[model samples]
Target: MEDTTQYFDKYEENLQREILKMCSSLGMLDGELLASEDIDFKWKEWAPEYIAVALPEVNNYPDFAIACAGYAGMAAAHWWDEDWGRHHSAEFDSLLGPRGFDDMDEHIVQKILGLTLDSVEAKQIMNILLCCAQKASTFIRHEQIEHQTVKAFHIFARTVKVMFRTGAALELKRLGYKFQKVDLNRQLPS
Candidate 1:
């Protein structure tokens, strides 16, 4: 019988081959193709800070890759905030409304959530959640002031959590990883 370690090694080899095959089929495994995309947005967003703390030995990863990693880290941080922070605070309610917050733009929501309305899947979900949040926050502030409802708070929290998770996924996809579901609870701050 084969040893357990040998089985594990064979499994790993098979996984690597499958991943390489998929990458090749998608035309993403080629170094030239990787180099061709304008990952300048990611690089500009992440390079300086990474360079500041990078270890000398592993400095060869492309700027875009480092930027993508940094974005993933930031998304993790934001998820923590959504999970633990008092997302339904009076201040937050006051900032969302039919008239909208004086300083808030719908676009600001996209920027905060790191989403764009251009993609069909992302656009549909984001539009629904953002509109719901805006309306719910407004209702809480203007209509529900007499009594705070668990239902309202639940809606608020769910919306915020979705926004954070969606943002994280977008950033990860931008970095070229096939996004799996983010485990939000695992990211909650201790």
Candidate 2:
């Protein structure tokens, strides 16, 4: 039988490969690419601060993979907020298209939870969740009185909580610890 760590390690590696490929395809793989387009406009100035805060929390992991996942989420939220939906892409319209930021908060949470991701799949799902967390946090910090941003902040907080719990569960399972799927809705008691 394959060791659990091997499974997690392989899963992490595969996720990284996919992230790299997706970023490359979007022309967002590095600093140079960041300068090549309008994508940077949507990235919050507070993103780096959020990333700095997140990095220490995942310090024990090799390559700080958790932080990377969080960063991916932050980036994806910026893109989705600025680039996706009917306003940005005509072909991408859906009934759930950005229906104000408050509705969008619920949408983001639903999107994250609905992923039903395996460890290998978590690479992408976790990234999007973390990104949403960071973006929402930025809005909350900067625009404290905005109702939509506040609601979004709460939703994104749940997202961060869920993402961390999910990652921990995967790691624990990899370490040969038995884990049951904790209802993510109840993952944050209170």
Candidate 3:
């Protein structure tokens, strides 16, 4: 039997491959996201949430994966709102197709939690879950494994969470959302 770490490691590697592929397909360099004096995005903020959603004991794995992905989408939206130039960029719509996917992370969660989509406020929520879900579908798939067990699903859940995070980061990059360092000391007037 393959060690659990080894098993999940494969998923991690493939995920990185896909992420790089996504960046290339979108004509964006992965280097732009690397740390520098100007970058200010703190990815560690989502760690606690990831632990809850991915590591929780669950009765259903697919649902777990879906829920984890949704959480990721919503978290990504939070970061999206931090910038002044948020909606000005057309990257997400162009890449994800059409419109309505701008805040899809939140939309998907709203949808799964039984929120009504008929309200005037929800009119923009439709037709978005699938596109983002599709982006993560490949990561959650479990074909190569010889046996489909609860263990595999758990890994899938973790994979789903990570893939969604990565996708969001890529989208944010494409949308021109960079984390600019805010040096409080520098901003203080003498």
Candidate 4:
């Protein structure tokens, strides 16, 4: 099997474009308002590639946009390991809805995480998560605030926490790191 780095190299361009498109779709890209420099770069540099990948010709299907967005977020996490990717991952989790939460136990979390960092599973899952994250981040950054922004932000935060926890566990497992299983109620440090 190919290593994570090797796998990512193949999809990095597509991942970047997918992230950009998701961000744009979420309305996060704004030229006028001055926010964090990193955020600006994320929109300008990363988002376009996302757009390219998510374009109808590239993705073909309607749902492909969402899938591309998720993939973008996952790829960003793998590449940057910075705030942009992290936030994008969080957003992706929010979009994924509640379907996967029940299985967020240590074993499942470990398995997913191991799969993610180790490139064990098809990269599609990672791609989905990344795309979701990019969309969420874009929403948070660009959308005008009403009651919905608060709700969305909350969801985004929760999702990010879950993904990070699971992703971290997987990374640890891949590295042959061991840990004790603790209660799920307690929050893991960010």
RMSD of each: 21.0, 20.0, 10.6, 18.0
Give the least accurate 10-residue stretch of model 3, judged by summed lDDT: 34-43
**Which is the winner by TM-score between candidate 1 and candidate 3?**
3
lDDT of each: 0.35, 0.36, 0.45, 0.37
Q: Model 4, 29-54: lDDT tens per residue?
A: 22111123333333334444444433
Residue 152 of model 4 has an lDDT of 41
Candidate 3 lDDT, tens digit per residue, 1-190?
A: 5687777777766655665565555454353432211112322444444445444433344333343443344335434545525522323222121223333444443542234556542332222324334544556554454335776665655555444555455445534667667877676666
Each model's backbone clash number: 0, 3, 1, 23
TM-score of 3: 0.44
Candidate of highest lDDT? 3
Please list the residue runs of candidate 2 whose C-alpha ends up more than 4 Å from where it truly belongs after superposition. Answer: 1-38, 44-46, 62-110, 119-190
Worst ten-residue run, lDDT, model 2?
31-40
On a 0 to 100 scale, what is the lDDT of residue 119 in model 2? Answer: 47
Candidate 2 local distance difference test against the native: 0.36
Instruction: For candidate 1, give the lDDT of residue 27.
Output: 41
What range of 10 consecutive residues in model 1 has the weakest lDDT sum?
Answer: 31-40
Q: Write the per-residue lDDT of candidate 1 for residues 135-156, one digit (tens) a residue.
A: 3244335434233354443333
For candidate 3, give the lDDT: 0.45
